[model samples]
Target: MTLASDDKVLILFRHAKAEQVYGKADHERSLTARGRRDAMAAGAWLHEHELGPELVLCSTAVRTRQTWEAAVDGGACGETVEFDDSIYSGGAQTVLQTVREAAGEAQVVMVVGHNPTMAALASGLSEGDGSSAAHECLAAGFPTSSIAVLRYAGPWSGLDIGTAALERCHVSRG
Candidate 1:
């Protein structure tokens, strides 16, 4: 599927299961063993689907970083990876601001963070015209290591509620 010149692909990814008590701050907590496998599964799914992103905007938290690393190990590739502070605890709109501020020529952008921000953002951006099945899956709740693939024909700065269409949703579990 070819996109228009200004079209963009956005993949909203929620970090996998994280340790509740890691003897450190919540931001310092890392992914659990199962989380690693789930992350890898998510990566493999992306690879198989040819959804390789050109830019990855991830949270600065340890668990998010670990998830990205494990995803990479599983075959996910991105031209650039940016650890964004806003994504750490920023709400959905704040996270959208980060994407709006993104400076690059990347057409495919992936955001890795926690929820309900991740899920909220995905729901807010996607309209009702794409796939009913995808929306139904998302309505259930965004599980760990779940991803929502959205497509829009405009600049990132213009992305907002009902601006994009939810192409699909997937939950990868090890």
Candidate 2:
């Protein structure tokens, strides 16, 4: 769980906007057309920034899965992806546990799920100085299909409060 140094990057992403249907199960809700475009844009941003995740842990919900697929299709990341049911209803603690369990060999890891866990995790982990714009955006809110990039210098198990520096945040504009 202890990495050699603070050379790891964790990317937190909230799933794109999903359809709202009365009486429909939340797990089965799918993304809308704009959501698809937003997801793709997020992926492209990751690719362009060279921050693509080596491993992607995505929620099992339809919208989250579709978001990951769109990101992958857009050349954001090409690697192993695990669909985790826990993330569907998990909180910040659950997300912390999931990241702690990630493979040590993975230099970059991404989690795709819902909010406010994503927002909470990002705000909770961030410490020290970072991009002003990124911090400002995060302070405002974590919108759907948004990405928060954090840099930490330690093992995954050692991830804790104020352990990381917020690198940047990107919100999909559709």
Candidate 3:
């Protein structure tokens, strides 16, 4: 598909599953073995799809950080990721604002954060004009390590509810 110069790709990635441990703060939880493998698979998938992100906005939580690290180990070719505390608990609106702040010059941008917010943002921004199967998969659920690939045909600052199309969606499992 031919994309206009203003077109941009937004990849909303939910962090892989984290171990459920007692006495640990939610932000301190770490990824489980399965979570690590799944994260790696997600990285490989991103690499294979050529969704080369110029910037990654990730949550400051430990599991989220580990998820990015594992994805890199699996060949996600990104050098730097901006860890934002807002993404950890900031509502979807705050996360959107953060992403808009990154509207500099990148064609592809990825955000790795917790669920509910990720799922909500993905669904809210989608114009429902892309892959039907992907849409179905996303509607089913935004599981751990799942990615919602959205195409925004405008500047990041121009993004808003129902302004982007859900290009593709996948659940990465290793």
Candidate 4:
């Protein structure tokens, strides 16, 4: 389903930091206190910017879930988070596919996951004309709880490298 020009926006967010438990599985690792604070800050930023996502696609990992929880608690987004196991280990292509599969009616969609897939996806989609500061931040690295906002005119299925403009990038500071 192709969309009208300038009708779609994608926000890619990396999950906040998590504690490195010596014996815990990566998927089961939980967020640290700092991570929780950062997640809340990220959510607040989204709310303040009025970029709240209509649909949130999040990874099923414990840390990701915790991050989303913190964000929602801070009123960053609305209800209805779809947690997908594939996102836990998915690469850039997988992330793109997930975004493509989002509901057609959703104007704003947010993905909360991990990196380097998040970083790669943001870097791949950005055309570098939106904001120089955003481009530089994205290039520097995708720190935990970082967000990359991409705007484009096309169906989610049509998302491709350099097809969207990097509107801005935000990194949470706890």
lDDT of 1 by residue, 9-80 (tens): 999999999999846799998899999999999999989889988899999999999999999988788889
Q: Candidate 2, residues 56-129: lDDT per residue as tens digits?
A: 89999999999998887776874888888878978999988987886467878999999999989888888545
**28-56 in candidate 4: lDDT tens per residue?**
99999999999999988888888877789
TM-score for each model: 0.96, 0.93, 0.95, 0.93
Candidate 2's displacement at residue 89, Å, is 1.6
Best by lDDT: 1
Q: Number of clashes in every candidate structure?
A: 0, 2, 0, 0
Candidate 4, residue 146: how far the Cα is off, in Å: 0.5
Once all C-alphas are superposed, what RMSD does model 2 give against the true structure? 2.8
Arrange candidates by lDDT, descending: 1, 3, 4, 2
Clashes of 3: 0
The residue pairs in collision within model 1 are none
The local distance difference test score of model 3 is 0.90
RMSD of 4: 2.7
lDDT of 3 by residue, 134-168 (tens): 88988898899999999987788998989988989
* Comparing 2 and 3 on lDDT, the stronger one: 3
Stretches of candidate 3 exceeding 4 Å from the true structure: 1-3
